[model samples]
Target chain A: MKTFGGPVLFLDRDDINTDEIIPARYLTEITKEDLKPYILEDLKLPGFDPKGETTKAARVIVTRANFGCGSSREHAPWVFEVNGITAVIAESFARIFRQNMFNCGMTAIELKKDVIDALFSYQDCPDTCITLDLVGQTLTVQGGGREESFAFEIAPFDKALVLAGGWVDYADKKY
Target chain B: MGKTTAEKIFASHLVDEPFPGAKVLRLDVVMCHEITTPIAIADLVARGKDRVFDPTKIKAVIDHVTPSKDSKTATQAKILRDWARRQGVRDFFDVGANGVCHALFPEKGFIRPGYTIIMGDSHTCTHGAFGAFAAGVGTTDLEVGILKGVCAFREPKTIRINLNGTLPRGVYAKDVILYVIGQLGVNGATDRVLEFRGPVVDAMSMESRMTLTNMAIEAGGTSGICMPDQVTVDYLWPFIKDQFASKEAAVAEFRSWWSDDDASYDKVYDFDLSELEPLVTFGYKPDQVKTVTEMAGTPVDQVYLGSCTNGRLEDLRVAASMLKGRTLAPTVRGILSPATPKVFQDALKEGLIDVFMEAGFCVTNPTCGACLGMSTGVLAEGEVCAATTNRNFQGRMGKGGMVHLLSPASSIAAAIEGKIADPRKYLPE
Candidate 1:
C-alpha cells in the first residue's frame, strides 16, 4: 500500500453530503480529470473551478467520523481521486464511500481522534509528514515521532481490489 | 451462540461473512432515487449492462424535480422520464402517481417481509416498516445493485427502541420519530437497525409505524423495523401472492424477527409519548429540533409540506383540517405536494384541495421536486423553512435555501403562524 506523504488538512464537520462534494448538475464525466475542479464546492472556497478544474495533484484528506456521510454519490471519491487526494483518514466513513474508494483504488485510513487533531494542528506547517504502513496497520506523524496504529481491517476480497489498483483491475485478474 | 432472524438472513447471504462481531456483511437488494440514479445509470451504461437485474425489483420514481417550473428543468425531467422508461424500470411511479417512493412502495406492496431492499435515496429504509432489510445506498451501489441484484453490508448491532406506554390522544406517530432523532442525534444510531417494540409501538397504525422507521437513515442507520404483528399481516396480505398470501403466515413470518423476552441490543432508547409535544426540526439538520411549543418565536421564510417522509394522504388530511377554517400566515410559502396523483385525486375528492387553495397553499403535482432543489419553490437568501421531507442539508431545497425538518402537522402549524408554531395550537388539542 502507498504511504500517503505530506501533512494532512483536517475538516471537522458532520453530515458532509455528496451534493456538497460535487453538485448533481455535473454528473456526466468524460474522465476522472473532469471532476477535480469541484471537490468541496460547498466549502465556499475561492477559485471554485468555474470550468471543472479537476484536482491536478495529490492531497490527503483528514476528516471526522462518518466522513463522506451522505448520499452514495460516487462523485465524493471521483472528485477526491481526480483532485490528487491520495488517501483519506477519518474516524469512520460512510459505508458507500469507504467501499467505493477501495474499488476506485483510493486508500482510506481510519484514524483515532488524536491523530486527526494532530494532523489538523500541523496544517500551518505544510512540510509536516505522516507515514502509513499497510502491512503494519500503523500511521505516524514524522514530527515529534508521534504515531498511532489503527487496524484497518480490509477483507481479502477488498484488499485484492485495492492491491490490484481498483475493482476493474481485480475483476480483470479474476475473470 | 444465537442469532436474530436478521442475523440468519445475513449469514445465509454472506459471500463470506467478516470475522465475528463485525458489522459488515453482504447485501441482497438495493434501491435508488432520481438524485442518485442519473449517475448510477451512467455508470451502468459505461459498463454495458443493458438490462437491470430485475426491472420489477427496481422502483424508480420522479418525486424529485417533476412538475418543473421552468422550461429548462422541464426538459431535464423529460429526459429523466424517458431514461427511466428506457431502463425498463417497471415501477416508475411518476410525479402524480409517485408518492414519496418509500411511502408509495410499501403502500403498494413492493416491500415484503424478510427480503432485502435498497434505494439510492437515503430514506430507502422506509421499506423496513414491513420487516424488510431496507437501507439507502449511494449511486455506485445502485449501479452495482441494478446489475448484480446485491450489495455488501456489515450486520449492525441492533437497537431495540422499546416504547413503554400508549400514546395519548392527538399524539401522532411522527412524534415518536422526532423524539428518537432528538435523543439519538443524526449519527447516534449509525450502522444499527432499530427495532421498535413496546406498548406504544403496538398502538401505532402501519402508516404511522412506517413514518417512524422511514427516517431511520436520518440517523445513519442500516434500517429501522417494527416487529410485524396482526397489523402487519392485514396491511400486507392483500399485496402478497396467494401462494404467500395468508395473513397468519405473514404474521408468523414477522413474529420470528421479534426479539425473545431476553433479547439484547447494543443500546436501548425509550420515549414517553405522553410527554412528546408535536416536534419540528428548527434548522437544517433533523437532529436540530425542538417541540412545537418551542416554535412560538422562531422565524421562517417558507413552509414545505410534502416529501416521501410526510407526503401521504393522512399527512395532508391533518394539514388541511388545521387550515380548514383559517387563512395562512402572510409571506410564508406553503407548498402542498401529494405523494402521487392518486393521493392528489383523493384530496380533491375529499375537498382537501379546496381547503388548501382557500388557505393560500399552492398545491403541486406529485413529484419529489423542490426538496431536492430540482425545480419549483427555490428560495433566496438566508431563509429558514420548515418541511416534512427528510434531510435539511444546505442547498437541499435550492441555492442558499435552509430547510428545517418537521412532520406534516408541524409544517402546517408553522405555515399558519408564518413562523414555527405548535400544531396543537392550531389543531384541536
Candidate 2:
C-alpha cells in the first residue's frame, strides 16, 4: 500500500473546472513536465495567485465540491502530478477527473460537506499539513496546535490501482 | 429484476466482473481526436506496447485545432496521423474531411443502438443519443481501450428524466437541456446515466437528440441515452440499410436495448416543456441558467453559433430564419461555424450561408477552435459572448472572457440586439 500527505492548499470554491486546473492552450506540450508551471494558471479564486508562494509550497489541495468539473482532460491530473501534489481532498469530484487521479497513481479523497467545512478553518495556518493512511483508510489534519482525523473509503479495485502505482502498472501486471 | 437501459447494455457487453460492483466490458468503438489521442499514443509507444486491438474499431479525427495553429499542435496532429497509418486504421478524417469529432463520427453512422463506445473527449457522451452506452475517459482508460479492446467501470445506476408536454414555441433542445441542467445542478447526475424518455424526447430529431446528449457531461452524467425508435432507424437508414432486412427490422433490433417498464431507477424526475422559454446560462457553470426574459438587455460583445452541441444544419436553419435580412448590432461580432463539411455544404445549398454573411456574420471552417479558445474567434479580456456551445466555463472561449450558453435561435437574437434577448419575438406567429 501507499500513503500521501503534505502542506495543504485550500481553494474555497465549488466546481473548479479542468480549464482552471490547466488551460487548454498548453495541452499541446509534449511532456508532463511541460505542464508544471501552468498549474491553476487560469483559476479566478479571490486570493489565490498562480505564482504565489503558497502555490509553489503546497503538496495537497483541499477544495469545496466538484473540483475538476469540466472536460475529460487527463492533463489536469498530470499537472498536479508534475507539481508533486499527490492528493486532492474535496467534498466531491467530477467523476472522470476522480478516475484520472487514481489512474495517475494519485489520490482523490472525498469527505462529507461538513467535514470539508471544518477543514477550511485551518487554511490560514502557515503550518497546516495533512497525511493519508491508505492501509487504515484514515486522514489526519494538523495545524495551529490542533489536529483531527477522519476516515475515508476507496473502491477495492481503485485501491488496488493506487497500490500498483496507477493504471499503467496495474495493466502491466494483469494484461 | 428489470434492468435499466444502461444496465442492459452493460450486461450484454460484460467481459469480466472484476469486483462486486465493477465490470470490465468489451468496447464496440474507441473514438480519438488529435488533442487527447496523441498523449495516449506517446504513452503506449514509450511502454513498447504500440499496437491496436482492432484497426477497424478505431475512428480517429483531427478536429480540435485543425490546420494546426502552431508547430506544437502540428506535431500533435503528426503523431496521431503517423500512429493511425502504422496501425492501418482506415477511418481517419484529416483537416478538409474533418469536422468536430462528436459531430463527424455520428454523421458517418458509426454509432448504433446497444453499442459500447469510449473516447478521450468529454463530449463522447453525445453518441448516447442512439441508445448506445457511451462515456468519456482519460488517457489511461483510452490507452487500455485502444490496446485491449476493453475498459472497466463501476456499475452505473439510472436517473430517468421524463421530459413530457409539448415544447413551447421558440424553445429548442438546447434550451430544454439547459433547463434540465439548471434543475439538476452541475453534479446532479454524477456517476449516473440519464435516460431521457417521454413525449418530448420522442418528438426530437436525431440532431436535437444529439444536442441533448452532448451536454450530459455538464451535468456530471456518465451518458445520456434515448430509446431507439423509427426516428433513429430513418436517420441511420442511408448507412445501415445493408445490415438489416428492413427499416422495421432495424427498429426491432434496437428496441431490445430499451429499459423495461418495470425497471428500477435510482431516481426519477419529470419535466413539463409546455411553459419552457428560451434559456441561457448566466454564470460560468452550465447549471447557472436563466430564462432569456430574466437576462434581457445584458450586453454581449460577441455571438458564436457552433459546436458539437448546436452547429447542426437544423441549428443553422433556425439561426438563418432570424438573420434573413437583419444585420448584427454595430458593436457585436458574429461567427458561424457549421459542425461538419457536410453541414457546411448543405447550408450553402439551402442559401443559409448567404443569409448569415449578408447579415454580417463571419463563417469559418468546422473546428472546435473558438469553443475552447484554441483559435478562430477568441474573446478579448473582459469581453462577453452569447454562444451555442455545451460549456460556459470561465475563460472557456478566452482568458478573462465570459460566455452565456444558449440555443442557436437565442444566440442570433443576441447578435441582432447586442444583448441577451428572447428568440420567441423573431419566430413567425
Kindly report, for each predicted structure in the order presented, the TM-score of its chain A compared with the true chain A: 0.77, 0.96
Q: Give the chain B TM-score achieved by candidate 2.
A: 0.99
lDDT of 1 at B143: 63
User: Across residues A1-175, which tens digit of lDDT does each residue of candidate 2 receive?
Assistant: 3447889899999999999999888888878899999999999888889888888888899999989888999999999888878899999999999999988888998989989988999988989999898889999999999999999988888887888888777766676
Every candidate's lDDT: 0.69, 0.92
Please give the fraction of native interface contacts (Cα pairs under 8 Å between A and B) kept by each candidate. Answer: 0.20, 0.74
Which one wins on DockQ?
2
lDDT of 2 by residue, B61-176 (tens): 99989889989999999999999999999999998999998899999999999999999989988999999999999988999899999888887799999999999889999999
Candidate 1 residue-wise lDDT, B1-429, digit = tens: 565546655655655433344333344455555555665566556667656767667777655566555554455446456766887766776555666677677777776667777776777777777777777775555666676666656667788788777765446777778778778877778878878778887877777888888887777777888777888878777776485656676677677765666656788877666766677776656778777777676878888877777888888888888888887788788788887677788889999999989989888877776776665566675878788877777877766778877778778878888887777766754
Calculate DockQ per candidate and list them. Answer: 0.33, 0.79
Query: After TM-score superposition, what is the CA distance of residue B269 in candidate 2 from its true location, in Å?
Result: 0.6
Model 1 per-residue lDDT at B2: 61
Q: Give the alpha carbon lDDT tens digit for every residue of A1-175 in model 1.
A: 4335455545666566666777654543434567776677665434333234222333666667777766656777878766667678887776666777776766766767776766666544435456666556666664444454444555555555566676544433332
Name the DockQ score for candidate 1: 0.33
